[model samples]
Target: MYHSGRLGIMDDGQSTVLHDSPLSQFADQTAEFLRYHVLSAVKLLEFRRIDWELVGRLGQVDRLQQLLGEKFRLVLDCDAPQYYELALEFHSTFQYIHIFNMTLPQFAMATGFYTQQEVAKPVFVSLLRGVMKKQQDHCVMKEDLARFWVTIATSPFSNNMVASDIRDPLYRFVHKILAATLIGRHEDDNKVNHHSLFCLMCMVEGRPANLASIFAWSMTRPKKGGGKSRMFGGPYITWLADNLGVFVDYPVDRMHTGPALSLMELKSFQQAGIITCDTPPAWSSIVEGPQVQPPPGSAADAAMQAAIPS
Candidate 1:
């Protein structure tokens, strides 16, 4: 009866065999066994080396996301080095899919992953500090650092996070870069400093007051007398002045007419106690010899004489 509709004596014997076999119950039990084994397999891989092929196949069966989600949660909860080791592996393996296929924020939402704030802001800051410290050892690549900076700056959760969360550590990192730039270690050191400054600006978005203070402090730091040369600080100050319109409502090309126009604007602010500028203009040499007459009634012109040191 199971195979053919034959109702002969042989068929009756086959039907009796089928009835006694409990095939339906056996099929259900086998399915249950496979499900258990698959879940076990995924769990085992979490603590050991991941088999991507197997994981991919399991994903095809709609288990990869759940398994990886569990692993990610474990990573957030555990401080054990093993968890990090496995987490790093998973991140590297699936970063393309995780980053491009769906943004990290979206992935976090879909998978119920914790935001950095939920993971603890201090912990996140500490991790950033650790990475920055390691960069001093030449262990981190500029590109990797840039990517990390961009992600933090653009990510929804991170973009809105309080600046105080990472302010001290970020200031420390900028100070380190300043020290390196002062030392003039390599030809590309200025570029590195510039890139670092840019990243810092990005990280401080939405807080113009804080950003202004940071730029003021950076530009005004006392320089050692009789130094060979300083490439980073002076140029950075000028860059900030030149790009002031980008962050504030100040006119763009309005301050670029005179040779020392930008410097005068900064000096006016410095005198007004709005900003400070201890370091002289980097382009002083080029702007010397002639005090280009400032435009009539120009505030920058009026401040120009007081701005320049004798």
Candidate 2:
């Protein structure tokens, strides 16, 4: 029923299923993509900007707009010709539905959204639904997020992934810990950190690829709380750069993935833009960073406190 019938685009909104039509193929591909990719309940409308950008790039949007402008009123105009009536409605929903046949790269490029070859992280889905604007090319950056990151690493930030003592904003941000960028008084700062989904999850290929990697910046460490126990074991610092992985980078080395970096090496990588601010491995409960827990009275609370390394 959903084939050419319900959509109102191809066959005048009449309930007829043409099993081998272009519209049917487009719908099938779209449904298959949605079924496997699992956008986590985001509506199809969320990706309309991508299709708009695609047609814009193809230089065919003018014709599309012309069709829409002239034909759309036929849905409502009481005295309009029957040939251009409600049966042939023109809507953005149809636009979104019709264009899902584009490849993943084509669909993802305009929004700077992507995923790894393996491992379907849910965060990426959230971001795809969130970034409403279109970025030009996958290699290009939005700039403001980059500036905001530089500002953040000026020192000490928080994330649930890294230890409280490891206040390296670079470590936190790169690891997806900071969640969103800070936007505050920055009259003198060149880039006022405006936090949004578009900049946060950008997976542009290159050095400092995503917002996470761009902010992989750190500052000199301080032995805070007068404690001397050192932190260890981030993606081990020796894994092949080609095999190593971060949030959006592909060819993930899952087991050797954490970057085994500590305060000193993190400072070094921060300068080179290899690491980012800290975020807890929200996926791993075996590890802990900053988190909200129940009041400190239950046995569970006691266990959590004991798990904290000295």
Candidate 3:
């Protein structure tokens, strides 16, 4: 029923719809395929290294027998507790970067991105643009990584709807999804995505790119059956407080800049369009009383717990 429609390849079992069209043939080189595969792998390997760099260092994992059994495609048997556990461990442990880089690039190479001299340059340019766009969409838009960190470190998380404590469950839930989402996917939004670079150009007296916020709201997660809540301890925060402060002098005491800026100071900054705080009820007003006692662990402890799930 289906035919390759080219030099003589055909498959009888496939539907007539399986016939490859010229669009299908020519579309393989674009970023859609690469973005899908890459982001899927990124989700699988959240907090892990990107694949393009790894392919040069190691061989790919191709043998399915180890994870899937002799049948290779059989559904996992619930009775097989050991294999079930193995499957969980496998999915949790596997970093899928290599699979993406190797497979997608192979498609691009076939389309002459890596071969034909004339088309290769444009293909490479397009590929770079796609990657840059994606990276911009995922990360916080600031003048630099430093500002990105500061914004996240000070963002509100918990309010009366969730808990009084700054380190509330809703906050963690939101950030966990956010960190993972940004870690996995990229998109093309020339506005906020391009902020840090544009600011950099401005610093050096170069022509700045048009920049805007990535979204109407700050980085936060929605509540169940309701509104959204902010998150803390984002990558930008950690990087800014620890690494970026050496240059910016943002006064990151108490592990973040929150302590440095009083409620009045924050309001003034917001009015000046220098920084935007999450809308009220402000973090202070959310709590009924004084601050909660520190949990069994400190912020450092929470970071470790996040790294390896129980």
Candidate 2, 197-291: lDDT as tens digits = 12322321111123222211110111111122121101111111212232233223221121121122333333433333345111111223344
Q: Which stretches of candidate 2 lie over 4 Å from their true place?
A: 1-310
Could you tell which candidate, 1 or 3, scores higher by lDDT?
1
Off by over 4 Å in 3: 1-95, 99-145, 155-173, 176-310
Higher-scoring candidate on TM-score, 1 or 3: 1
On lDDT, the stronger of 2 and 3 is: 2
TM-score of each: 0.18, 0.17, 0.17
- What is candidate 3's local distance difference test score? 0.24
Worst 10 residues of 3 by lDDT: 72-81
Give the alpha carbon lDDT tens digit for every residue of 32-142 in model 3: 333222222111111211121222222222221232222111111111111111111122222223344334333333322233352345433332211132345323222
CA deviation > 4 Å runs, candidate 1: 1-85, 97-101, 108-170, 174-199, 205-310
TM accuracy, model 2: 0.17
lDDT rank order: 1, 2, 3
Q: How many pairs collide in each candidate, listed in order?
A: 0, 23, 3
The per-residue C-alpha lDDT of model 1 at residue 191 equals 34
lDDT (Cα, tens digit) per residue for candidate 1, span 24-47:
112333432333222211211111
Candidate No. with top TM-score: 1
